[model samples]
Target: MTKYLVFTVLYLAMYAHAGSVVLTDDVVNIRNFEIGYLINSPHTYTIDEAIQAEFTPAPNRLSLPSNQLDIWVRFSVRNASDSVIACNIHNSISYFNRVMDFYETRNGVILDQKHIDLFAWTGDTKLLHGTDSVLPIHLNPGEEKTYYFHFVSPAYQYFEYLILDDQHTLAELSTKNIFPVLLVGMLIALACFNFLLFFSARYKEYLYYSLYLVSSIIWFVFEYGILSHYFGIYGMRGHLTSYGLLSATIFLSLFVKKVLQTAKFYPLQNLALNSTIVLLVLNLLWGVVNFFNALDISVYFFIYAIAVYFWVSISLMRQGNTLVKYLLAAQLFFIFFALFGILFYEGYLPYNWWTRYSIAIGVTVEAFILAYLLSHRIKLLKVDLETDSLTGAFNRRTLFDQFMQESKRISALESLVFVIFDIDQFKLYNDTYGHPKGDDILKIIIHHLQSQFPESSVFRLGGEEFALLFTAENAAAAQRKVSDIRLAIEHLSLAFPESRHGVVTASFGASVIESGRIQNFNELYQQTDARLYQAKHNGRNCVVM
Candidate 1:
């Protein structure tokens, strides 16, 4: 029995030194290094027992599969320098909410101890500046110390550790964080720009896009530890991270539905998009009630939502939707890069900047492209609303707007002439030949009128009624131009079988106003209508000026 006991003690001693890291330089990267894990709760094993626990090498990065277990990691550092050295043990992941107990021991006796709880908002105040937990160590030349870390979290956690000279650690951390800081700044600027656009255009899609930017910015700032330095809020990082991700998903879905007009072309995809939003909302509610495990299941839902969005975008692109091409280009890079980033964080991929800040870069490109698309869409909608579909002339709304603008620019020496004309005996002609033929005759008349008075602005006031505004050199010139248009219509001699003259005819009325006169469009319209009445009474096919 005494021999067996000695053998067990020897085995424990050998296992404890198996994962030692020999420190021979100024810095040591402990990532993916040999380490041992105790997959039991903290209370289940003492520091000595944990040191004797079976050891396994972690992946390039370490990740816990489930949140319900506590993991104990053990590694040793041997100081090979000729003089005493001071170093800092740093864990760069700031988004995890966990409690860590660090122990340093020599010859089976603990020499120093420290505790860091990311969710407690206390402990290791000096470490706050670096936005992570840090342990300072002093080791004499040729001395070796074994370290143990007890980590407890309720969600998957990541670990990336580095040991560096204490003096240069803070400076190096600042330099490493510069790019993420710039990324968050750019995202905030984009959010503000889109927010202002939403107000100016009153477009719901712009509002959704702005909200998406805000959510993404919040997630990036918090995930990258930028907010951890200034805020004392603890235990809320995981919840806030989940909130930002879920809200971003909802906003992105809404924005795509509106921008792509999915309801019209891809109704099934639109329905699926909405369903994902509802599921996200439910997940958010679940998170609110149970904060610890809120994101454990919701992350999969987020993946599904992103998949639905990509499918809809691709389907639209396949249908020859030009605007969707921009969406596809912007979202494709973002989705793939973001997926890689998440995998990297979960320890499925090696650490790199592309995997770290992929979402930020993707979002920046998306914001610029989407803003351009919104502006272009607004311009096209304006054109559609202001144009007359039938006659290709400016509609009444556009005519009024142009007239108001022209009135503002008129000089004292300029003269404005307004002309109103319509088909004579138009009701009788329509009653005899039907409305389709009447429409064709109207189209022919408009074609001729537009050709004759190419220099003037024309408008179709209503059925069988048209108007033109001419700013010629003088009133005489305007009158001569009007007479030419009247003579051209008579020469056309368009056949109208039911007319008394067996031909189409029209009457014209004109009202000329000198530049000095301050006359509104309503006044000019009345004067022109009176002249039109006189021309109709004097027998159709004549011009009254």
Candidate 2:
């Protein structure tokens, strides 16, 4: 008799522990529940059968076994407060399950039933826009209601139910959604900036990157349900999502190829990129032909493309491609977050804000890194185009460009100074010491001027001749700065046996124009050239201002 009594008590305690959830105004997240699931069940059960089915206490995390099964979660909540309570039952994370039927019952009589088909084109308009399964209910004082959730999907899903007051739901959603929205906005801004760069520089890589960003933006917005919820765009979910991924693959490959100059540097990698692009184009066409049915296979194509990109990046990095470092870092970030998201979806990691939005967060980081890489590339290209290779001074073309730009900005308070100078006897120096030593002297002269003036203002205008452009308060200030430059050039004690002096020296001719005295660059150049001849006539290695 004692053994039987102990067994009975244990059984009753087990059932009681999984019994009704007593709800109060303070109860925000509901946890206690009874779950009964069938793995690959051959037959479906009716609502009556499901209501009478036996269930065990649910674990903290309930993982689905297979898509070919049914799951039922039951929990009864009784209002323990005097005032009416409005609550929402929904998944903690935003993910769509194919078929979710929610039922509210009182003593085996149904109060409310909702069938949610997330992928359907038409459904309950409110729920259709929602990313997750939501069931809102009102409980009067002392009212008890039993809730049942039945789920079926083509793929495995994990549902973590949350019961919260309406205000708490709003607050929680706002807190969760704010970062992703901001990240998307940042990505859009980056895309726009890249577009502008593409227009300004006419770089194919920038256009490809902008396109990649646009596709990624589309993918993230639709994947997270923002388009449907906020913008009321419900159609073309699958096609758009697949199109975004496919087009992103194509454009990113183009961007990498163009930026890395793979065809010129690494022919094999270039061929690989070309092949990947072709395959993706085929996949894109396949998607278009098959419609939404092709969406299931699009992810695999994307994964394969990303693997190719990663391999190419690593290979280039191994071959001493310095720019590949940024690409590799971006790839690693994306892969890490993508893997973490997969783990979260597969129930290995706990559901949290970071886990839920890991992909978007990673992509955002990757986008900025790539953008920085592109900007760095552009800076390097600009440097190569504008500067002399030997002495690191602005070339003749840049000299004219700078003068034109400065002309536009000159005002009544500003004066422009143009100085042209050359080595007093460069030909004799080159003949005596050979061209290489003459080259050394030219570099030294340019270096001396660079230390005093902005590098952009100091120009190597072919051979040993150079030009300097600067702004000053007045003519006196401009003359003082030019004299200082002449002195600095003389101070560079480079060997030049052909010079009248033992050390190398240069002659300077400067022309200053005050504000409102507008002279074109050619006129200014002619004036400075005349002064240069005057300086040579007066005495070699003197300043003619």
Candidate 3:
């Protein structure tokens, strides 16, 4: 009776000591765990050694520093159902560099074992699928098993484990992966659109934008494990990620320079942007030879680049650049999310959907905004090309084009008047005063002309010479308008020390195309030129009609 009692006591003690977890649902998140780590050590731990080693209770999520270390994590689960159930043991973190070995044992007898090393090149195509990292576990009613995970990595690690039904796990993983796939598709589409715009418009900025988008797509493909699923090459993931990011940065800097015309307007910012590009290129090269150190150094450059871009954008906006304001708003939105992503990666924030994909979201928003901004910029550039730089009036080319268009609609009901004017003794005035003062005089003349003929279109044909085209009811009305403008110029009495008048004046020549006249723009221009020459000969301050 004493022997039997001792045997019963031993059996009950064994049952009580078994760390079995009863599963009540399709998914079981095993959070109660313990972890032990060995730094710069060989992978030679046996089951007994692992069991005997000291382990501390892990937090809700385990994070390991980036180092050459091996980590051992222990956990157990039990089945409470009447029938046997098959489930998948999933390590939720899918970082590419990790080499994971899973060992399953029940009552000190090994039941199954599996190894997942993504860096290995020799594998079946399906082996590269991210889901293959999960281990298969079978449990009979009331059976308990302990699982040991031996993880080794050369990069920082995050750990979370789940016990899920095979079907449920597949469904969940597919649903979870859909988001990244959609993001990739969106990025590719945007890149293609920008490429098309580049070729169609022949704008170099669009080309740079497309290249930046392409690089971002490449980085996200590897970062999100989509490349691993298709290519099964994990060794290049880090290198490619670094290369893509650096390339994207370089192209983005170039795009900003072109879009903002930084060389012309913001020379200091341009120099800083170029310097960042050089640093990024050097960092990319270093990453090819020594990855971890390069990665560590790159973070500072990235921060610097972002700061410079932000500061330059703000400065431009403050200088009354309308396009830069839009760009600044878009960049602010992107920077906010980018900072969140950085904080999440550094373990300062919880890993939620927004934190996990914040950078991607920011990139999408920025891409769209940038594309719209580029189109708007193209329109503004067209306008600027048609305008005279010295005087804010239409250039000779634009004036001729407008005249031709207006000529097509000439009729008896509408009369056209063309007037040419120039500053009197302007060459002598320019010779006496430097070109800087000459420019001021020209600007003042344009301001006065625009103010007098607010409804007419004015054109700066050449130096100190301007033309105005207006619609009038009759020749008398057009003559009256030209006489008023000539009198206004004489009355201003602008001081010109070298001129005989001692005050700046203007000479005007007017030509009227009466109703039913079908004169071409060049013919009208010739007539106006002849009259202007006559006016110049008949004492420089008078109007010739």
Candidate 4:
């Protein structure tokens, strides 16, 4: 819809001269439009007044034929206070050539305008029902400026409009038209950035975030007239429909669960995750139902989706961490107006443009989530300081911690064995094959030994040698297991050209203790180290006690 809309807007702007709003001395009369709100006092809206919204050029309608826009409106900010007070202009797009599309989630609904025929049939820029929102500007104190708005008829909507006479600041300005674009920019940027991040990290979390961004961007496109503008979304007025909204919602929910680590935290969180899955299932069913029933349930679908999203944000906030709390706060930042809009569309309440940007608020929360995860990883990196970079295994520093653990376990159970193994000619291999190859061989051997001692905790006692500590029922069993491991290594097949003995081989030593063993691991180590020396003295490929 965009291509055509851009083309049409451009063609109209180019081939035809658009009517300019040139302000005259004191008053200005719009030729082809209506002046519902004046520079002194713009349009005022109150539900008690039957929602009177005055349009310019009378009748509050526009017919843009070859750049001749028949509809227009003027909003004038009037300082109606003792001091310079800020005012605002707000407009709601009520009707457009909306092509409906439906999708299901939670066995209910998911609304994405792109599912409409217009998305598939037309360009995104076409003049469809511009579901876009605009910002109602907050005028400065005592400022008097008339802002004019014009739109073509089919893309025009006459909804409850308001020129706010509040003391709002620039910070409190509500985005009307540019809101969607800013949201789209945020979502698209997030999508592209996270998509690339997934490529870099290649983790499921990144994929979830990336998908969330993508869904958000798609939603932006669907929400704005972009999809309908070109696709003529409503073209399939009587066909089957499904929604991309389900994918967006489900992925968003899943991403949140994963990021917050809430799924495994409690039964309720788990239940929420499961329920979201169910919602997704139900949503799919409804999507199918809507596909066949035309685009009938689109509005209901979104209403439910909005509810689910809001629930997720609330749930996250209730978790009460700084990150989750801030996330919730960010979501709440946009949710009030969104909920208000829901009230508007549901009842006679006027739609709030603020509500339309719930997704933007969502993006903010998600971005913060991303930052939190990154920082969390950084914290973990600091704690896991004793790991080999090449193999990611515990290094020398890890042994000190392990030593204390083994000490406690040994004192409690008294049925533990310690085994020490040293490569027979690791230095020779290293010299012959180069240091890099030697490092590779050591890493492989470490991996093999670590897997071999299934019941034992293996630790690298610096280079070329490793130690294991484990509990067994008896000394005999422990010795057998240790011997068997040596035999397995001797018999193990490997590809090491520098190895002297057919394959890489190591000498092993074992010491079994039920009681009256070495007082501490250092003494126990001395005993085992002696045994290891005995093995090397006796023969290379054997275990000794």
Candidate 5:
């Protein structure tokens, strides 16, 4: 009786252990569950069928207990050759086991995976179930059963919070695209503005700015994939894109060359231009190599920009014009943008669309400034062309243009006064202290005549001679003004140290239109010339009226 009783107790204990539950995450996008109790021995059971369902898994997310936090996760078990494989998981944290709930009343292994509310452990963590053949319903070869499961931890859920991350590269591209358009519009506007300035000013600086603006637009189009995107230049993508930097280098080099005009100072200006041409051709060849090899020519852009800025600045400082000072300002801006691109590519700064496109802003603004400076330079040059360089007075060409218009006024009136003067001993001064010192003496005489005619106008009529047309009370006041001019020239302190005449002096003569006696200005001009010789013959420093 004792033996029988012991056997019964042993059988009960074995039955209880056999009915214990076992679960596992298999090689599928779902979880597998099985009952460890196998009443029929040696029975090969295939997966009867599979069905997809939805349910909330039990939550055990809190550290308090397994049942404290509801646990669930969306999962699927895909067909894997002859078995089921569970996958489609996030590796944000680590690989972990998933828990799955099956609708018990379903015809087959129905898995509910709608509400994920659980934490599954993986790696070296303790498992919730044991490995047993009874726990896993095996399938035949070339057959599969799919199911759903949840992945969650039995205890901490907040510590395993899901982190949102973007996965679509197109989204990033579109976002980047928005910024480049704004930059492109700004650059185009800048170029157009400079074009307007060029038309308004007609200065060479604007010409250079226009060239740079064109190069920049081309560069930006190349940089943004626009060549491929809009222009369908993908077949020539390698050639087009690689040569963009090279073209920018060349156009900008030309701009700098024009901006600084260093050749004006350099004894070998043409030689420098030739060498620069060679460098440009070399850049083009390297660009071809880069296109064939997929090697980025971005570094060349930097090297060329630096080289250009250095050369331009040096040239401008040496012998550049007013436009050069402004170009030098532009160089600083260009260098700043180039360095920014360098730092970004070197990993020293974050690469961003705005950071890349902002170079257009610098170029646009710098071009505008250059355009303004060039326009001003053009105006200054125009003023110079109409004035005498040595005497700082209006030249005879300007005087003649004014004379034709003034003749009408004198012809309308009953009287007018005209005078012509020649420095009597200027030739002696020129023969004495070389031409440069003679030039100073002529300028001194011009200044004296100009100051003496505070209300009248005086003009240099070529070397050592001058003329004036004035309205006076009578011919006597005009003759007095002429005498005053001669006396002023004689009083100047710039004496020729070796003049045979011993001192500088000038003779003047005046003519008056009395009762329309001067029918034509040509006759009046000849009469004044005859009187001028009489003053010189009467001795220097005197006026003949």
Candidate 6:
């Protein structure tokens, strides 16, 4: 439907210079070829002088490339239909132009002139109906009018003229125009969430990613005219776009370095990343010092940075860096869609919804992918923190944490049991066979305890001392569980000839209490330890509860 409407409007606009527009109820919107002539001059011209000046046929897209010059567009409209026609002419490229002057004239007489100052915080620059650079035109039947627009800017400009009739279409268009900018807000919200997570995780990668998200948010705000259209902020547009991209690239490099562990595993790549970041920072500072016309330069550098980051991920993934795969997947999504959006702007792809809003879609997907990857990383970090390195048993700290958590639960219907045990004459066995053998015996003991209780609840308290905590139906059931663990350890086939049993064995001590009656982990630990002392005195391998 939109393509058909655009085609009909273009067909009428093509003959607009030879004849007038035959307005009808079906002509809801017109764009691109509405302007009849374009004049690119080295100096500004008044509306009176512009009327007599020579002009050339205007194309749908024109580039204004000089800060010292101005460009003017002139067009005429007539309502041949029988009813009054109300429509709006909007400059979608208003952000690229620092100053926009619209002149409405009839019969060589100036009737209305409106000025939009891009740098101003009030008046003409303010958002109207949540849109920008709009000039409402109302014409009665048989009325003819001519309109002229003057534009001045520092960098390249894309002038997209859109005319829409005032029949609920303007509000619909406003919503479509604002949708992409609202996606930037989603990125901003994700950045805030990661920033808060950084405080709890204390991971520098999270911090870097958060900062990168913020820079990306700023870049999109500038690139899509949101800064000027929504905030009425204009001057330094080039500088903000360039600097924001560079900043984002730097932080993304940092995030890749930390997440992939490049510094530890791939020092040369890490050095390359650092060197690229330094160069980007230097360019950023140079732009700040000089008037910041380095958008092209920044774009080139940004592409180079992305290439280097991509190489690092591919190289690391090949070298068995498991985390790099996720990074590569995320970057692929961003690069593919963003490149298509860039190509669309460069006229390589036909104008369509996908090509137009590709960047917003790309960023939204990549943000969520990175967020999930970060969450998975935090879970792995938690596992590493809780498990013992040598025997793969839960550490002492984990034991205490589990105790605290279980104590907080009010729905427990069973008694909680805490058991402490150690290999009989472990020191003697170590002195006789060696410390390596002693370590193996400790691993074996943990394995047997893991068979009885969960690996998460099997704790390695210290050298050769292990613990287990679980819920039991009663004290007798808890003692039976501890005895079963002791029997499993004794049944191990490994020989420890220095012991009285001529085989590896462990003494067990247990303390049981009703659920939700716990006071402190240390108190329970002390009670279990004293019973373990009694077991040691009673015999070399026995259970004391």
TM-score of 2: 0.74
Tens digit of lDDT per residue, candidate 3, span 433-525?
Answer: 878888998888788878887978889999999998887888889888888888777777789867768888888888888766758778778
List model 4 lDDT by residue over 1-545, tens digit each: 99999999999864332222222222212223233521112333322221134433332222222112123344333433344433333333322423322111111122112222332444333322333222323323443444444333222133333333333222223333465666667767766776677787665566886776676566555445344333434433312222444566577666656656666664565566657666666766776655523223444555565465566657766666444553455445445545544443333343234444444555555555554654464355544576666554566677657756665666544666778888878888787788898788777766776776566676667678877777777877787888777777776665555555668888988887664453676787789899999999986878887
Query: Candidate 1: where are CA atoms >4 Å away?
Result: 1-46, 58-75, 121-126, 260-270, 292-294, 314-322, 388-393, 404-458, 467-496, 499-519, 528-545
What TM-score would every model get versus the actual structure?
A: 0.77, 0.74, 0.80, 0.40, 0.54, 0.80
1-545 per-residue lDDT for model 5 (tens digits): 99999999999975643312222324222222221111111332222322222333321111122222323322222233543422222222111213323222122544322322123222322211111000123333333343322233222121111111122222322343455556667767877876787788666556666666676677666455454334433224323544544555566556555544545554354355446556666757765666533224445545655565566556656763455676667667766776665554343444344454456556665656666655666667776887789997777778766666565666443456677887777776677667898788777777766777676667778888888777666666666766766666666755655543556877787887654454576777788889889988887667878
> Residue 45 CA error for candidate 6 (Å)?
12
Best by lDDT: 2
Per-residue lDDT for 375-409 in model 6, tens only?
A: 77777778779989889898888887788775665
Q: How high a TM-score does candidate 5 get? A: 0.54
> In candidate 6, which residue ranges exceed 4 Å CA deviation?
1-21, 25-28, 31-78, 82-86, 99-131, 136-156, 166-176, 237-242, 264-266, 408-413, 428-441, 444-448, 516-520
Query: Cα RMSD for candidate 6?
Result: 5.8
Computed on alpha carbons, the lDDT of every model, listed in order, comes to 0.74, 0.76, 0.75, 0.52, 0.51, 0.74
Rank list by TM-score? 6, 3, 1, 2, 5, 4
| Tens digit per residue, CA lDDT, model 1, 402-492 | 8777766777777777889988889988898889988988888788878877878888888888888877667888888888887777678
**Deviation (Å) of 4 in candidate 5:** 56
Report the C-alpha displacement of residue 287, candidate 1, in angstroms. Answer: 2.2
* Model 2 per-residue lDDT tens digits across residues 152-221: 6444455666677767777656554556678889989999998998999898889999999999988887
Clashes of 5: 28
Candidate 3 clash total?
Answer: 0
Give lDDT: candidate 6, residue 63. 38
Off by over 4 Å in 5: 1-209, 224-244, 268-274, 288-298, 301-308, 311-323, 345-347, 351-354, 402-419, 447-458, 468-481, 496-502, 509-534, 537-540
Tell me which of candidates 2 and 5 scores higher on lDDT.
Answer: 2
lDDT over C-alpha atoms for residue 500 of model 5: 39
On lDDT, the stronger of 1 and 3 is 3
